[model samples]
Target: MAFVGMDPERIRKVAEQLRQSSHQLTMVNETVQRLINQATQAWEGQDTLDFSDAWTGQHKLTLQQCSEQLEQMSTDAIEQIAQQEKTSGITPGGPGSALKPGDVIPGTTIPMDGLTPDKLNAMSPEDREKTLEAMTPAQRAAYLASLTPEQAAGLLNGMSPEQSAGVLAMMTPAARVAALSAMPTEDRRKALEEMPEAMRDEVYGAMDREVLAQTIGHDVTLAKTESTLSVEAEAVGFKIEAMGQGEMVVNADGSSTVKLHGEFGGGRTFGSDEKGASVTAGLEAEREYQFASPEDAEKFIADLKHAATSVSIDNPNPIDDVWKVLDSGHHVDRFGGYLQAEGHAELGEFGEIAGGGRIDVLATPSEDKLEASLKLHYDASANAGDFAKFSSGGEVEVKGELEHGQLSKIELKASTNGAFGAELEGKSSSGALLTTTHEVVQGSNIGQGGEVKMTLSADNPGFSQVKEALQNGDVGKATELAYKYSDVSYRQTVNTVLADDEHSVKLGAFGVDVAKAGYHFESKAEVSTLIMEKPAGSTHYYDISGGSR
Candidate 1:
């Protein structure tokens, strides 16, 4: 029973042969069943073994020879079956036949190959544009979202400002900011400036202050220098020292002297000494003495004596002859020259100046008259204020009349070739009537087109007579009295009535109204009986009894 093991050489040879022959032997049913059982064990906290102990050695030998042999065998078997069906002319599923090129197989599907080159070439430009426009921003975003960083940049390069802003506005804040950061500086700045305030602030907040300052400072410095002043002045002058409040001390030739204050025309005065001479000027005029020797005082006295009598009287009129020649021709027989041998002229023309060499005719009386006549025709369309002007040569003329100072009837005319004229009529401060009818025509063209006539008449009704007549209830007398005092061609009627223990007077009129409408008047005997009524017809009927008498 304990027989000797086989010889070493024979045993080694037999082991090698058995390992080589392992591929030919199929696994035993029991061993196969064991592996199946182990693999099916629920994979719960245990390692799986595919071969039992009986087949371990042989399985190792076979697996060592080819690890992926089972997978290759399965693929080979499928390929062989396909080839066999094709050669036998039978479909794989139905009769084991393979599909031929361009054949449509029953119960088999094929995907549409990605867009064909021919189909893409056939698409019209309009169709492409419409397709792009029809795409929702979110859809487009998804397409862009899938791109690599490089592809996204290249795609964005073709977009316009409005297009970019719209696309970026739809992006998330973080993504938009990242995209802006990657842009060039100028592009980034333009994009940031165009963005909404909130977005711009967010992006600017993320920038470095130093970089921002440098960028903005360039523009600010450029703007500042563009408007800078570049002109230059050449001279820098000297100043003089004031000896006192008003006098200045002049220094020259190694000596000083006080000069009188001559900066202003009427010379300024400083305090005076007992003799009433200015101390500063007096000291400067006096000769100084140094107690060095008798010779020094003697020399100073000599200099003072020489200065006292050094005044010289030169020609009083160096240009006397030249001026005499000018004076002779000053009275030349011309319209504008000196009126006398002295350089003076009496301006006789309406538009000339008397004293000045240059005469301004525009500001003269004649010019004023011309302007007045033109303004009268043009500006008379509206109720404007009076126009008047003071000529340069002391002339005053009435361009128009003042409404507040209007005379009822009077016209003033200018005297011909005269300095003064007379007013036809005017009102005095005491309400007395003044009239003058002597017409003096200053202008030759007067009354050429038509007679310019004016008249003055009474404006106030005789209040004394109306008051007396109304108190007596004499309506007829009051009517006659009111008509006599009124200016317009109108007849007035007065009526008195008693109502509610109060007396009321009613005044009515026809013809020549104050305005375009006829006149009306009302009065209450007592203040208590008066009532205010609304204004009517752009005119008024006053019940003045309620007001102070």
Candidate 2:
């Protein structure tokens, strides 16, 4: 139950498997049910946030599934005709030791030989109904389960609609599938054919898709996505950003022909206020393309990066030499070797850090790997984190994989010094939905810190809540939700610098900087993630934002 080292995902899978096999292994299932509860309990009160995080939906599903399975794990109750719990919960018996009709049907004393098929057929429907009504629901279920597949089918098909519904209402879904499985092909078809439309559809819909597909050759194929990539995008009032790769393969006896496709959208806007005008001012799109082979996809991906390098990397600059080093064995692409940026960033949770950073990357396409280092020094102005215009500097080392058109995996090791000293590291996989982001965190937390891991999904409820808040013109509510949502799990160490290094700072109660302190101390969250949309699935884009406090 103390699943400390055990992977939660593995535990979740095992619980699922046990729930499915609970029928034949009842008591063990009960134990597993209890264990699942324990495991769920372990997740409570773990994080410090007012709103739900990424795992919110999954945790709810786990508990709901556990409860449903518990209700269905009936132990040895159906084997005996007079079980206290009832046969409604048990597996249908096999021919080896199945109970006879007389044993299962309450108060029926007729000998098996005397109650011939002919005699049963001769009985009036009213008399048959009366006989069935005499038995308890449990006994009726047992009687049905005890029959051979053929006999069970005969009984069901012979029953009136009202009787069939009555029996189905009492039996569990598992029992129904079992009973249906035992029927003869033609008889099973007839039984289902007569089922109420809704009931029939429900039963069939619950069946395994693989079986259904294989049975009827229901092959469904979506166009292949050749590649996905991340983009460095800019948006004005009217802007859009999208990148994609897809392809169709048409074959003939001779050879397959080639098809080329690509898409791009981006925008830019400068605005002073938020207003409900000019819907076309923003640009966004989902694009698809086709490629002849994976190589074609790779070429497109590589070319995009190459174009980006040419646009951003200027000639005659020291950074160009970094590009030469990057292009030693291969041409640098989007995440190419040289990156020099000069911009002032205002972190929402944390205070303002005004500075630029330089990035140098060594990419080994032969090894499908990339290694990069980045350094940035900043002069921090007064921020919510109590920084009094201190100088800060940091470095980050990244090792990652270039797969398809994206960084499939990345590992970051980083450190910071100056007003605050800190060390951080994390790993990220876009395919896994979320990642651990490493930043130049110089212990400047006006807000809290942790190795915050975020899982991204279009269906993520936390993200959805934030989106809804913003849509409803609730900026404050949206900010709070967004911060709480993806802050998954973070670890913070508040570096205490002796007051000897203290300086004066100011605070405002209502839009006016009225209060001043020497070397101010307050928490400010160095927040990001407002503009960037965390890619929901695998794409070529860098799955990380390189700059954070």
In candidate 1, what are the lDDT values of residues 1-549, reduced to their tens digit? 111322222322333344333323323433565675676576543233433343556754565445235323433433343334345553312221122233322222321122222332244534323333454442333333333333333333445555555555654343455566555544555555456544554444434443332222221110000011111111111111121111111111112121111110111122211111111111111111222222333344444445444555664443554344323321211111111110222232222222212111111221221111111110011111232211211111223222334422212112111121111222222111332122121111001011111111223324356557989999999766554443121101111111111111212233111111111122111111221111101011222112211
Residue 290 CA error for candidate 2 (Å)? 37
Q: After superposition on all CA atoms, how large is the RMSD of candidate 2?
A: 22.3
> Which run of 10 residues does model 1 get worst, by summed lDDT?
220-229
lDDT of 2 at 128: 57
Candidate 2 lDDT tens digits, 1-549: 233333322433344354445433433444555675666665656452222343345654555566456433321222222232132333222221233333434567543323433454356656555555665543444444444434444455566655655545444344555556554433444455455543444345443433222211111111112223323222234434333332322211111122232334333333311211111111222222334334554555565456445543344344554444334332222223344444455555454555556555555454465545555544553442333344455544444444545534433434343443332222222222232221222232222122222332233345577768878999999766554443122223223332221222333343433322232122222222211112121111221222111
What's model 2's TM-score?
0.24
